[model samples]
Target: MDIKRSYKGAVEISVILLFTVMIFSCGKDTPGTIEPEKKNEKWRTTAVKDSIGNQYYVVNTLDNKLEIRVDNKEGKTIFAEVCPTIDPAEIPSEAAMVITGVATPNKYISINDATLVLKIVMDDVKIQKKYIQLLANINLDTKKFYTKKYKIEKPEDWTIVDYNNVVHWYQNTLLVREGTDYDLNRGGGFMGLGQRGTQLVCYERDFTIRYTKDIDANLASYPSGSGGQYIPINNFEDMAFRSDGLISRVQIVTSVEDEWAGKKDIVWQNDLKKSSNIPADYSVRITDYNIQGDEVIASYTIFDEKGNVKYKRTGKWALSNGFPRGYTTE
Candidate 1:
């Protein structure tokens, strides 16, 4: 009887221990590990009106920083709450620090525009210190407008040549390629209808430059090309932005015999893209040019087979794959 009772007690104790172990194993996940929280890194633009009813663009960053950029002023940032600490003694109202850039969340503080108006509002206390610091960069009357002329030297002894300018502000690189094609009938002189072919090669050169004036501090460049983003410009007015963008792509159907059609298959290396058959005699020229914010506006005249102006167009230059293809107005 004593042995029977001892066995029963041992079995009961083992059962209790096993149940406790199972319970502990099941509860292990509750406190053993933790999941981290994800952060939103998108930056957005906000617009707010100041005490005097002037509007501006203000950006609130993810890390509790505020960026203020003006159209013609130097940009300012408040990295810490105490650094841009607004003193209540100079307080005007509760709307001063409220920044309204664009409601859309994006990294750029400005609203897809060269011109931005930002207002800061926080408890109606004006973040005037930051605004005033940034404002002085624009209000200086000593600023002047300047222009740089790009001198593209025409190769003196080329048979036919074409010129194009590639302006990529984002890359800080300007590329110019001169496509020259020369045809020669050699080895048979005059009447043999000698081996004829079109020779094509594009001489590419870099023309990107930096502005040497103090005004460069007031200007801004756009981000990478994502298609359909305009580098705006109005031809009739003075430009306040970086540049006037231009891209022209015309359908050229050309049928040249012998050398050109026969040799290397006639390759085009410049901005002039052949839609169909591009003859070796077509030429394009740009006359009036203007750079506005986000768009390149210009006037171009195309010379056809007989050297007369085939057509003249005025509008925004079109782009393909971050490079200008032709003229576009829409």
Candidate 2:
């Protein structure tokens, strides 16, 4: 009977020890134990095509990172990049959330031939208080990626006026934002009469990104008591690009009035290797004579502010050499 009791007690103790071990295992108190957060590990992939039929595969790693891949016409991988992750806590959430006139939840907003614009938003319930809006511009050919953060309040008040490569030969994107000029001084010192204008934010590119506040203008003298007047002269006007993605010609309004303006048209020479300015008022029209073998023969006519013909010129430009021969001037 004693041996039987001892054996029974030993069996019970073993069972109890097993149950205790099971309880401890089920709990999260084990040494070096960690519970993985599966939500953060979730990710999604999206594919987009550009205007030129290039394929772009974007993978939102869901960890504040993006994996991008670009494929060319033959489905050959041309470029790939793994963008650096951003800290959600460091981003501000109070600003506006509208992009390109629409409130988007994380997605590609624009896809040019060689550029991609992505809008990344982190507004999950867990991170609603720490919401973040990031605009990323990725260049497939240059293998460059840049990001900018915006905090806007009103959606209807702001608009993206222009977003594209002003000069196709140059791999830079020009972004123009149209909104209310909040500076009371710009509105003739009034509240509701704020000036509505466009601001040149920056040139998105791999290198040499330029930031400008407003268009280049002149401050005209005003009466001693009043603020000076702002007169916008040198403004970006019409431009043309060659079939080979080179700058053909660009016209700039040098003066508000053509009476005093000179050299208002810039013609790209030598396949855009050099530039020549037309010594006259702004160009009224441009005509392409011929394009062959890295050479462009073009003609343009400039007119004065009074609609009178000021100058006319015809030139042949080549990529290998600047104006190979003398051009005709009228």
Candidate 3:
């Protein structure tokens, strides 16, 4: 065994150990100091339509590349292999490549076609190239828009079978309107029985108003009636659906001149004691009744055009099926 180590040998070993320790230490490459490499984010697709009504999906991938595919009007894959070079910010970053419901009609795929991948790509990008598709079942383009809508609340109430498609609903409101008429006589001869002095006598009668959702409700045309006899709003009496769909509920609209309706005793309120006429500013709505446990009662409501509840009619509903009068103490 050596009694003492050589100074030269010790110095050489120490230098070697110092160099190893310095090399192992991560000075600038420490965990917190190093930043992460950014990933390519996806962007929503853009759509372009040609003159002949064809749609194409413009997609920008994560690696800053632009791609286009036919979204609708199949077999029109002329844009295949035409990957335009563009930044990813050209499209919506959060938007997924989608096939909107507007293209439902033009969706078509042939079984004989060998290529299952719809669009052909040419550019080599870092992002994973995936085919995305969203489709629709029914076609909405060719179907003619029908503006007629009918809301039939009860199953067997008033229905337009073949004339117009009826949409049924569970809750319905019945509107039964009654008005009063007057029979006047003048009394002068005998105990107010004979007519000489004027005496006002009155009785009530049914207004005979009808309800229909038809756009052509036989209400006289407006503006034409203005010059001829009545006010412009007085003649307009038709309603139609804004779009063709099954209507579960509807608000029947009516327009009338405030002065004319007031003077003519055309009471929208249907009150015998009080006078009610259509307001020029506010709207009048009466809910038609539907069947509720063998009972039908019309309900009415009046509100401003903004849907604020202003006035509500009494709950005195006309019962279709009830016990005979005087049977129950009201």
User: Which residue pairs show collisions in model 2?
Assistant: 96-152, 270-318, 271-318
Clashes of each: 48, 3, 14
The TM-score between candidate 3 and the true structure equals: 0.16
Query: Over all chains combined, what TM-score does candidate 2 have?
Result: 0.38
Error of 2 at 284 (Å): 19
lDDT of 3 by residue, 266-318 (tens): 21222311222535555544443232343323345656668786765523322
For TM-score, candidate 2 versus 3, the one ahead is 2
lDDT of 1 by residue, 166-209 (tens): 12222122211122111222333321122222322211112223
Model 2 per-residue lDDT at 163: 22
The candidate with the higher lDDT, 1 or 2, is 2
List residue ranges in candidate 1 displaced over 4 A: 1-270, 273-278, 315-330
The sequence of per-residue lDDT tens digits that candidate 2 reaches over residues 53-93 is: 56765544455445556677677778666655444343224
Residue 170 accuracy (lDDT) in model 1:
27
Distance from true position, residue 179, model 2, in Å?
A: 5.5
Against the correct fold, how does model 1 do in TM-score? Answer: 0.19
Off by over 4 Å in 3: 1-281, 286-289, 304-308, 319-330
Best by TM-score: 2
